[model samples]
Target chain A: MSAAARRGVLPGFGLSTGFTVLYLCLVVLVPLSAVALRSSSLGWQEAWKVVASPRALASYRLSFGASLLAAAANVVFGGLVAWVLARYRFPGRAFVDALVDLPFALPTAVSGIALTAVYGPTGFIGRHLEAAGVRVAFSPLGVTLALTFIGLPFVIRTLQPVLEDLDPEVEEAAAVLGASRWETFRHVLLPALVPAATTGFALAFARGLGEYGSIVFISGNMPMRTEIAPLLVMTRLEQFDYAGAAALATVLLLASFVLLLTINRLQAWTRTRAGAA
Target chain B: MSIVVREVEKAFDATPVLRGVSLEIPDGELVALLGPSGCGKTTLLRIIAGLESADAGEVRHDGEDVSARSARERNVGVVFQHYALFRHMTVEENVAFALRVRRRPRAQVAARVAELLRLVQLEGLKGRYPQQLSGGQRQRVALARALATEPRILLLDEPFGALDARVRQELRRWLRRLHDELHVTSVFVTHDQEEAFEVADRVVLMNAGRVEQVGTPAQVFEEPASAFVMRFLGAVNAFKGWVEGDRAFVSGLDLELVAPASAAHRARAHVFVRPHELDVHRAPVPGSFAANVDRVLPLGAAVRIELSAPGFGGMVEAELDVRRSEALALAPGDAVHLSPRRVRVFPSREDELDSLTASGL
Candidate 1:
């Protein structure tokens, strides 16, 4: 046996490694590079003008801001849902557990239509909200609602297994050590849960940042307010400004990449702290 | 603190787990709840810890009724079988948890944690997490954490059940020394009889959701209270016979043994003895029966001789010291005389008074 043959534990390492790299390039890198290549055709100043336009800036704020708000909301309520599903039993528990995956299964357009019917003015919930002077559809809040709807399953699914695997004996130990229920939860349970919860938060936030279909109907695509970056890119495409659309797409992709990378670093730091503790 | 449990009965769903169990633990005494699996020993321990509520019972600590008190308010520290250390907390933090939760002064909490860490001899590893520690080290950390609050009573649920034999033995001795220094009223549950005998001042033997016997280790071993306790304490030989007047006649062999007056009233009785109490002789002797040696097993310090008599229904076993076995030079198929040194006679189950009287035979 030569040294090269024994380099990896598995046989055919070279062939498998080549195939993985080729498949990744063909499927992911090539398409992403095309967007960059198209944007680069325009001069740097022209590309900056397109991406830094006031309209584009407002879209960026709404997109990132609403996604952050929705992900935050999911981290709170989605965590509660996961906890209940993992630790308790009640009537309709199985049904509710299955319903958590609805956003993953439902078509985004159909969910958009349904959410609009329920929260739009004169609709089931919107009529009551309208009487109180609160509007949901055709607003930034509506965009957040749509994002929240799509991002819930990510948080819940990521957190469910971690919560279930937490030993109940630890809680009992805390209690028997003279800690109150709230104290036990704060000092014992929450620290163990933080890393997994942060991972779930990052996943939901990344998913919400790029969301488009459900927000189209609920957000009404109002420029300078409800228009999201994905919708802005579509608007540029519709006007036959392919370079401008690619420029905006490249900017959104880079911003998301940076944000996701930061989140990954944060997650890694938390995991190391937890492990070192 | 002394603890008293009065008729602590509990049932899970439709299955009864503890059936009217009662116990008393004096202050600073170490007691062991010994039983086989599914025998309600752990359940009883949990009930006393206030982790589980009894269907009908009262628990009192230091003469105050604590039946309705929550586990958090009971001021009892529990060390779980698996230690249950907070995986995300360092050892110092874990030990400081109780004091911190109670809103004690920072310096006081730190001093107490340091004191406990030193007491458990884990002072240097205070910054390490639970996963970084070995099983025995984790157990010591757990002990420190449990003692941090200065609890009135301590409960351990099979503390060394998860460790290997070597670590288990070392920790058992360490626990005994720690218990003496702390002098806190403590109770622990274990199914291993040897562990219970080795560590506990008194052992509470339980079976079928009830306590079969409660006594010091020496008392329980030398004088078992019931047939279950006798068999549970290593009684391996049984002889069935009918008692008449002052003697019990063996059914298969031509032998007769003295019987108590109470045993003479029973139509059928079982004589139980430990293997070491049965003596083997090379020739048939008075009050001894002839048997053929079926097998010889060599244990580390003792030799187990399996013997069988002609027309006997079951095999008989006798244990002899290795030196004595070597002196005798016994082998399989050799004829020998077997005599019992001591035996306990109890009425057989099938010959209960109701069955015997109802059949009118």
Candidate 2:
């Protein structure tokens, strides 16, 4: 089979590919191409000067660092939540599951305000933490906290179905065959949940990277220290520096695309492994 | 090793699954827990394996009470009907799973797994995954895996129930031979009476969460303890009769037979006789009741003649070999004489026994 036809495992190959390209052009490619055109109009030397300034680098650091931290936190906590929901039966399970998706339904602006009120220096539980000299709101840490809050649901929701589909009999069979609970989970459960967890991680990371509304409210928008890539893009747009904004947007878009590709590869690899076995 | 289950009772919610179930499975003996579906046979096997906890009972293996022990600690092997083979592993890895989990020495694990694969006659297929193997091959792999740990007792829950007719029959003989060679105390749960009769050294027939009869295959077939057992064993031609003095008088037909023992106490009774045991001759034989053949079904090797005798309200199934059927020259609507050799007398209280037999529990 030809290379193009070989990737035709998905149904209605030509039609789906055409639709996917059209959708990408409408939603992503056209806007991204416009951004690149604007950036190029500044000429290579001028674009580099705007993108590599110390403040731009600092914003890059804060944005990438906070996103990584938030994504890492989601991986651990989301796995725990998925395990509990999948492996055990408890009262209010449906309600707990519904609560996990609350972030998806709630407006980001509303979530940002809620987080600030709950964790700000003079707010409810924040007063005690503030008394201890541990600040949460209007800081880099607050940005991370807000990102974590928005990114958590992606991981848990992605993994819950996979975890539920895992056969309990496999674990029992492992145990009877002499493996302890830890061994069973390590050998039988973890291998199956890994691909799902990786997909969740990538999704959360991508979401955290481009996050604007929630982090902007919590970070206090201090340039060089608190401002992120998305904020910088917004700043450039406000100052009518469309070329600089496009350059920054291009970087975020490329990183997100790479991460999504990796996630797709991981999902395919996992399915093949599961099917072969 | 011998397994002793004492007064075992299990209940799910408010319904009892197994009640007052007790049995002794001697070492190296293949005991079959045979009953129809919902008969609690599988529950009894699970209880012995410590997979299901008995509400009130003690499970002892080799003189040690294993009631408090988990399934792993009980050292029992179970092969489910679905095989439940680990699809993620190859045949060798699946067989070696038990050893690997116990953290046995690497050399020993490899050697033992190799040996087990050879025993199951899948040496060439060791590297193949379960999905790559046939249905029969997967089951053999499951059996090899179960036996990997050198279990004290092996439990099989309808292992061949999922196989095709030809494979099921072939596996039964192979399993009997394997049990003899291994000499391990094994208990298998099966709803198929023929399977139990063919494979088990002793068959334990269960009905309604209770042991209806426990005996050798011939014993159970010849002397079923209850009316339920007689019917469940095979198709029986039943004759409702009343006992007077030493004889049982047929209700509708002018027929009488001397009661054997304890038959006089029951005012009304039903006699059980196997279909093949009824002699059908072309001529009106002596001391035989005349019956009109309603239909004749030619099953490949055997012919079944449905007869409506005067005494029995419903038709009775009478089996005859093709040759015997040819000699009789029986056809639909033909008049013939059916003389049953021996019949079992069951009390009228056994009328509800049909429901019990049908439910198999």
Candidate 3:
């Protein structure tokens, strides 16, 4: 048989690939192209003026900086939560596991409202912190708090299954060989977990970078201080500055794609290492 | 060195898995805990290895109580039925794991691991992972790993039970040689009587969470302690009868009492004789008992002739050599005379009804 005949039955390959390419053109590539086309209608000098403005630059710093902060925080604490949920059989474990998926299921607007009620100065936890003189809402810190809240499930869900799939027999064997608990986790468990943890971190980061609805109510979107990129794009659109809005959106979109691509590369690399081992 | 287990008892929920099992194994002796499934043999082995806790017993190593010690602290090596070799590590790395975990010197570990590979006769295969090896090779690697720790006692749970028939026999012989070379106080658990008899110096037959008999292989196979052991070893012709004075009356059968005079006074008794012990001949031998061949089986060198006779309700098996078989012209319908040279008679285990599960009746 010829090579074409040999390749006749790759299951769902043609249909799924066709669907993926069309969906990307409609939802991702076409929209990105439209954003680029609209941004290009502005003269280069004018586009530079809109993008490099001190207000725009400050939004860049806060948005990217706060998202990084949130993603970093999630990588550590989210991992702890995932490990606990995966390894232990505590009372109300089901409830706690369900709570990890709350961010995925609940509307971002509802989460924003709930978080504002709880963390706003007049709200329950806010009052206690206010007495301690630590202001949270309407600050960049509050933007980070919102992003962390929405991004946590990405990290935990990605990691929990990987940790759970790892066999405890490996650990038992290690212990029987005279290795202590710390050494076993380091030598055996951690090597297997590295890939999953990295994937989780990348997911949380990408999600935080594009987050808008959840942070808007809590951030108090002040220009040059608390305004983030997504909020800035909305402000330009509301003012009918289409060129400026499109330019900013295009930049954010490109940054997010690059970050996600890099993460995907790392994930592929990790999977290869796991398979090789 | 020497391992002593005393009053070992364990219970899972309300069901007792082990009931007061006791044994003393001398240094360099390879003893086998031999029994059928759920006989508490594996449980006893785990208890000695410190992988499991005994509820009411003590396991001592060199006269020191190590019952409460953790598996890691006990410094005993164990080989599981599945080998349980780490899939991620090469043969050398797996064998070296115990020494590495104990934080031995790197140079010494390398040398010792090399020595162990040679000892288990897998020198060139050290670089391969467990999944890359066959079942027999994996078991050998497991044995090598267990020895790598320089453990005083090695516990193997059905180590060769997973292999094919030919491989199982080959490994048993190899294990006997390995035990002789290592001289560790090794305790292996197995249900296959053939494996136990072949590899172990002392065989402990367990039944229903208790040690039924403990002796050399020949002793246990030849002189069983109870009906369970006797039936488990091989087929034995038996009769239930009542004893009166110096004679025993076998119900529904006529035979002179051959049991001890002490057993002659017992109200009820069970008389047993092995199949191969009965002598069968074609012509009417003057002193031989009378019978007819009910069935015949040619089992390689010997022909097993199952006989039925008048006044005896059950069939009795007698093994004859090919020469004797030809002389007798043995067939299913032929008349024959069977003379049993040996018999064992014991008092009825009627009281065992109350503790049915424990007595293994």
- Which sections of candidate 1 miss by over 4 Å? A1-20, B244-246, B253-261, B308-310, B350-361
Question: Per-residue CA lDDT of candidate 2, range B235-335, in tens?
Answer: 88777777654556564443344346375464787677789888897776655777899999999999999988765556778999999999878888998
lDDT of each: 0.87, 0.84, 0.83
Write the number of the candidate with greater lDDT, choosing between 1 and 2.
1
Alpha carbon lDDT at A112, candidate 2:
91
- Steric collisions counted per model: 0, 2, 0
**True interface contacts reproduced by each model, as a fraction?**
0.87, 0.35, 0.25
The Cα error of candidate 1 at residue A13, in Å, is: 6.3
Residue-pair clash count for candidate 1: 0
Report per-prediction Cα RMSD to one decimal.
4.1, 3.1, 4.9
Can you write out model 3's per-residue Cα lDDT over B187-217, one digit (the tens) per residue?
Answer: 9999888889889999998888888889999
Candidate 2 — which residues are off by over 4 angstroms? A2-34, A275-277, B243-249, B254-261, B282-294, B307-311, B350-361
Q: Which pairs clash in the backbone of model 1?
A: none
Q: Write the per-residue lDDT of candidate 2 for residues A57-141, one digit (tens) a residue.
A: 8988888889889988998998999889887899999999889999888888889999999898888977888999988898889
Residue B16 local lDDT, model 3: 92
Measured against the true two-chain complex, the DockQ scores of the candidates, in the order shown, are: 0.72, 0.47, 0.30
Error of 2 at A139 (Å): 3.1
Model 3 CA deviation exceeding 4 Å by range: A1-79, A82-87, A131-133, A154-168, A223-229, A232-277, B234-251, B254-361
The complex in candidate 3 yields a DockQ of: 0.30
Q: Top lDDT: which candidate number?
A: 1
Ranked candidates, highest DockQ first = 1, 2, 3
